[model samples]
Target: MSTVAVPELAVVSSPWSLGPLHLSNRVVMGSMHTGLEVQDDGGAGMAAFYRERAAGGAACIITGGIAVSDEARGGPDFAVFGVGGADERFRAAVDAVHDEGSTILAQLFHAGRYALAAGMVDRHGAPQRVVAPSALPWAAARGVVPTELTAAEVERTIEDFAAAARSARDTGFDGVEIMASEGYLINQFQSPLTNLRDDEWGGSPERRRRFTVAVVEAVRAAVPDLAVTIRLSGADLMPGSSTDDEVDALVHDLLPLGLDGISVGIGWHESRTPTVQAAVPHGAWLAYASRIARVVRASDHPEVRVIASNRMTDLRDGEAVLADGLLDAVALARPFLADPAIVDRSLAGSFDLVNTCIGCNQACLDRSIIGAPVSCLVNPRAAREVAFPARPTTDPKRVDVVGGGPAGLAAAVDAARRGHHVTLWEASDRLGGQFDLAALVPGKEDYAATVRAARAELADRGATVHLGHPATVADLAGSDAVVVATGVVPRAVDVPGADLPHVLSYEQALRDGVPAGTVAIIGGGGIGVDTAAFLTESPDEARRATEFGARWDVDVAETVVGDVPQRLPAAHRTLRPGPDVTVLRRSGKFGQGVGITSRWVALGRLRDAGVRMVGGVQEYLRIEPGVLWIRDEHGDEVGVPADSVVVCAGQEPALPTGDEADGRPTDGLVTGLQAAGVPVAVVGGARDARSVDAVRATSEALEAVRRLAP
Candidate 1:
């Protein structure tokens, strides 16, 4: 196993004080919706989830946004406190955090227009009516215009916040945080674009600040003993939203209301800005928090500590941000999801073992948004902490895992940890199969971390990994059980001229580089879209410099445009005019298999790279030497001229075959192995071609190994 150098210790591990509350470290587990609540017994899963993070070394844990009122409820599964008469349910959770030597804060919120769209229903079983400061709808909310909140309703809402805070204190929570960010109810009133009332709650900047100030005062007075923190959107990023001056004035007004600290959350859900996705650089939103911190530090209310959030996974980066005095502490949500023991691992100087978040929100935010129980893409046992605890096998045996892809590696690690004698075989020299190609995608280099972690884990757990060796039925004869995880084999599309020299597979193109000039790519799934991104110019350093130079009327010359190398391969060489790439999908849309959280950003990047996308192809006529013929959705024959045609027509399961099989290869490994008088299980793409992603592959492998016990 390769060792990674630990970053120098800094303020991340140092003790800090948030008013009267004393913390063990600067690491705070920011609020993330886990959807773990039982909706009856409060939440056994929720309590266990917090306990895991607390045990790992978070100084503070903020509960997922809990509804303060019936109208404010985010969804049926969301945690509720004051209005639901279920405050007692959270007592166990708070006590569990305290027992773990960490302070827990309840985040109270009202979703407002976001609420109705979230499918939150009232106790009467009727759909909750959407309400906002004005009769405006969030752009994403479709045509669901919210009812304007009356003055009496506004007063009641403020009272509900105070009641929630009081209930949080009563329930043994050490602190309470008001969720005024993320275009929630409070933020709806804060943003000028959403709040268009001429009344006291809107119009002037001061009036727009009224609701937040009143809530702070009410909550502070109601729960004087408990710490009070307010989460504010440093920038809404929406058109006509609150300016920096307005935010500064609002902070200035709220600072005098006995606030404990401020957590700066950036961007709104309605805004077309990239906030926490993979494409967004780490600490991209730190400047927003810095601005607020600067205002607070320079003000008479210097005691108000600022907490920065969004895309802060690495503790080293957090340390840098703290050392620069950008913010008092860093709040991480997704990192905790990826690895609950992030703080402990960083403190122990085992940086390599830390499962860093790849910023793929597939299992976390995407699932939560659809009212599903949230889990981590890499770490499957995130929310199921109690349910999925690793246990040793009662009856251990020798296990042979064929293939060293994500599925095979996962199985080897799990089997070895369970006291089984495990050996993993790979036909290739490396472990990661298609996952290596996935890492090569633009803005997706973080995926390599997962591959590295898996490799390190295989080594640490004593799993014998044999590279460049394919396991046969004879090799697994002595093993108690065999797991066939050979993954997938790319299938060729049944089209004329597919065998042309200019036409290449997506995998081949990635490995040997795309040919220069115009290229037509077939298929528009995740692979095709990612391949398009790989072929196009990355909108990073060079693009930025070019844009900057163009704007300033400066010749970029040597810096932006360099002399072309003459020794490069024809396939590896990029032409002077650059590549004109067009992606064709047989389906209606591109990036169909992409996670909802990052798909928009990925497509946006592809768009910015001048990649032409055409979907709903009626038929593919054929691929010629320098031109590809296809019928559009309207049955119009389009001759797309190209230097090369790259086929990303997807993959098929590479199940074991030959004399080891009962009949055909598609009969599957389980049937084949069983016929040969051997017990066998199949996982990942080998089990089902559609199950090609990391999330499914890892999960299926883990479950398969667990079932193999005894």
Candidate 2:
């Protein structure tokens, strides 16, 4: 076996050195929801998940927040550390981490008032009162209120943190990170927005710091060898909450407690601060880290280390912060999800191949909300490192991959990594297919970057990336296997006047440009809605509409047959961010297809932007020049004026070759691969490819069996 050289990664020689215990590397994988704890084997899957990260070179891995007690747990799916007392299963979790040559840390946390009261009501078969520092409604979900915690209850909470730390040490963990950020229970006690207690745990800044300090002291006493990392909300960044000066004072006071390190994080649960956005530069929260670091560094106490987190993606930026003495180490969350071997890639100087997490917050947090395992849009093996470790193929057969979207790139890369000589053919000049257009959208540059990174990685890994080639059977001849990733195309509507010169498809516009003029978009799906929002000009409007550019009252066309199309569930829809735009409904009914939550937000944006509504229209035709003829509900045609007609209508799979074998749509590249008798797998948005991963794995497994046949 050849040793891979990784340079960019900060080597941690000891876990205790960083915190209470020495660490091996500076890379700390952030906590994420894996949904693996709920596996039938009782955290067996979860153990494997952590083991992979540890094997990948994480010195210390922090498991997703666990409930100190039952009431604090989000659900049965959440990993419980100390609930029902620490047991053998918990020890198994710790052993799993240690067995991989890395230390494990458990986050001690409580939801307090933020606990899901409704969820608890359903689970317990009765309603339960939500507890917090004060009787404040959960800001995100209104009408669900929490009762204030008493002074005694506050003391108990501190004890809970200490007990959790003891559990960590007992369970063989390196240490515990006190949950004091993101407006959790500890955060509620620290923030004035949630904590309105009049006693020693609330009301005054000194009192608020009391609970945090006590938790630190108790945990330190409980596990003197275990590193105790404090995740602090340096600046709540919320109105009427703890200010920067108060945070500074709090950290300074805690510095003498012999803490291991302080991971400075900003933003509270109810914060209006934009944590992830293009407007905010990378490593935007370095200032907050620097502030706390300054306090700890300047203090007489010498044990505590300062760790910088929050939007730290680039190595140069992280090094800059470390070089500037702002932080001792950098904690990366989403970036790790994108590439677990980020340290290796950085050390290899393959920054181009390192998937730059665009802060999309899509596969990471968004998927977590739906109870799906956290995943990465760019790196396919991110969370599946153990389940799908890179292995050499037994057959060493040739493989061909068609299309170059995320799924295709992943399949090709995996196949190549398995020691197969692979050919990746893209019909277009570039590798990324439909995703190429996605990169043009504002704030979506990450999508493009991910595509570029995948392409570069494939190239470096020795996959033949053949641009400007459409895969065909003749071209794929004799290939052991073929992987098809032919992506989806725009959905079209059969409405009249669809062929006008001004009527432009979203793909065409992205490939070309949406000329600066009046424009109307037909669909209100994510693409359509996003297109409509992007066409408008002006920053305020873009923010309001959440579109690409600043909001400008540009000439735009929006097709409404008086009714909105369905498929736009408010839960999944992204509302246009600005005004200076209009929506024309085909009928009087608005948001017929949009989801309730998304509809409210989108329609609210449209109404706020002064979008014009055109209803009860029929027989949309080209009437005169520069106008669309629309017949009313009564069959009366009227001319609606417009400068450009933009089509955001849906799409269908446009097969490059009309090859229907045996009276069926040929399974395309996937079919071709199987026919070629090569092992293959598919992934990503292509539903057909989901099953391919299993097939490829099984095929490789069978090949191994054959190779060993006597």
Candidate 3:
């Protein structure tokens, strides 16, 4: 890894073959459930989405879980093979990818017990009963238990996979990968924890393998000419589940099923392992892939390719893993969302230009928690490629983007790319307003990389950037139009004694490490959680999976023995070594405003670090020397002992106000600029400062630049 060079990444672009299917490169995109699948346009939107990624350099793209049957649907937007208009969607996606000179694979899926049965209905518009190998509830299910599948019903499910594969083949798919991993129906049968039945589909390890083996054999028999593959779980990562011997034996048994490839996935959806979050190290699951590859490559069918998936955010890490020659390919899903041209740029030795996925999950995974279309935090035009076409602007204008924050930088890059003569103005000495500050926190180191990439992008696009030069109203008179992205300013805490010398802001605590003493965070939003993490950690210790394992006292390399809570592994973090940190919130969720997928991970780490979280603060009595008093929700006065008080109450819009009585201008800067005859487009927090969301900021900024006046 230490010797891996940037040029060597061309290996990912090297052509590879899986059985009869020949791919253009080794870089493959795993399936991602973009909520666009269930659209009524006969998959026109999903097709465009895939076409854009393919054009951007995705070689072999796997379609998000296409339900084999209506009962197999995972959530609200699953595109079922034979249900409703899903086939139209599947056909459109296949045609779209093939039109781009790339290949597509239909991932035949079944949610089993993981399906939200309460919200879904069958083709007949009746409640689709959730069923699994055994009548068991998923660990995350809210009092929803699946009905046990009968032996005949299990056979029908296997045939459902076969039927789905045939539909895909007819629709012109290059391959079909059985969704047998991720605690899905097939995975449910493989693990004893979920399959507690004594029936033929579950009884023993051999019987457990029967369901998966049947699925593979049926799907292969259905589409023998297509590149048949399956995403199998190399490690269930669940305590009291299948053992290493069982998983390895399953991989070996599948080799005889005429499969073209096996992409080894890690952990079940309910597994108590932190495999995909930001805290996990890049390439953390490569060993598991290597483990499966050993069983595949050494078998009689040696040519069957094996792919390593999960947590490989950067293609360089994928290249490094492939350089070892243990695995045939690497599968990354979210990285492609960040930058569709990630592979092409990396292979061209322009890796720095790629907008890498930092594994934040703020935009992709978190949005999925609420059934929203997955987009990228860095690249706002991800799934909405058709809506936000990247075509060069027809009428380019002299665009001046104010404030060098994420919003402003995004607006500048977008405007410059659209062929506008762009000039960016920043009041501060540096760019990357919030991003630069976010980079100071451990495990968020890739944020700095984003900033660097944005700066380089701006320079490459020939945009003039001015540091330490705050553009006055008159300074922007030369511009055809102005984009005001002046982000936000941290709001001052209004509590009594908030002005005390010991009371510091979140920016201050993050920029300058807190003093060596007890620290109390007043708010528990995103910044407060980060501040708590920053204060409790010592730079002397490591972060990532290694740090996470040490802090939580869990073995990242091995599975835990019991179904104790699913604790995260890995993330460059420290234990209870530095100042004692406490996060107190007035009310609501402790990790509110944080992404759904990330909030739990952040709060879990905080708990593991001995950070006391106090919610239901009715009153902030006063901030004294060594203690801050507060009223609890139960009308109790509580003393929050602290040596330093950090305010994480949030931020407000940083915009100058103008004369509203004239009705000629909205804000002072915009009014002044407009009076000078300079058209203005207000964006980011400057328009309306509610919360500091990089997603909303970048999205709105790009939209602003897109609609900028001529």
* Per-prediction TM-score to the true structure, in the order listed: 0.90, 0.80, 0.92
Q: Model 1 misses residue 152 by how many Å? A: 1.2
Against the true structure, what is every candidate's RMSD?
4.8, 8.4, 5.1
The true-versus-predicted C-alpha distance at residue 250 of model 2, in Å, is: 1.9
Which window of ten consecutive residues has the lowest lDDT sum in model 3? 558-567
Model 2: lDDT of residue 615? 54
Best by TM-score: 3
Q: Give the candidate number with the greatest lDDT.
A: 3
Q: Residues 1-710, candidate 3: write the lDDT tens digits.
A: 01222466767767789888777778898999888888787777888889888887788999888888888887877878766787788888888888888898988999999987677788888988899888889766788989998888988988999998999988889999888888899989999898888878778999999999999999999998999999998887888888888998998888999999999888876655677887666666666778788887788988889998887767777777787677898898998888887777776677678887878888888887567888988888888877787778788789999999888888888787778999998888999888877776655666766777788888988999999987777678778878998888888987788988899988777765566667788999888888887766543313345676665434453221111111122242333443377889987888788777777888887887778988888988889988988898898988888888999998988885543423454457777887778778888888877867889989998888777742
List runs of model 3 lying over 4 Å from the truth: 1-6, 538-543, 550-579, 632-639, 657-667
Clash count in backbone of candidate 1: 0
lDDT per model vs. reference:
0.78, 0.62, 0.80
**Reference-based lDDT, residue 618, model 3:** 90
By TM-score, the better pick of 1 and 2 is 1
Superposed by TM-score, candidate 3 places the C-alpha of residue 441 at a distance from the truth, in angstroms, of 1.3
**Candidate 2 per-residue C-alpha lDDT over 61-162 given as tens digits, one digit per residue, 9 for 90 to 100:** 777777776556554455555433234555766788888777877888777766764655423445545677788876554477777777777677778777
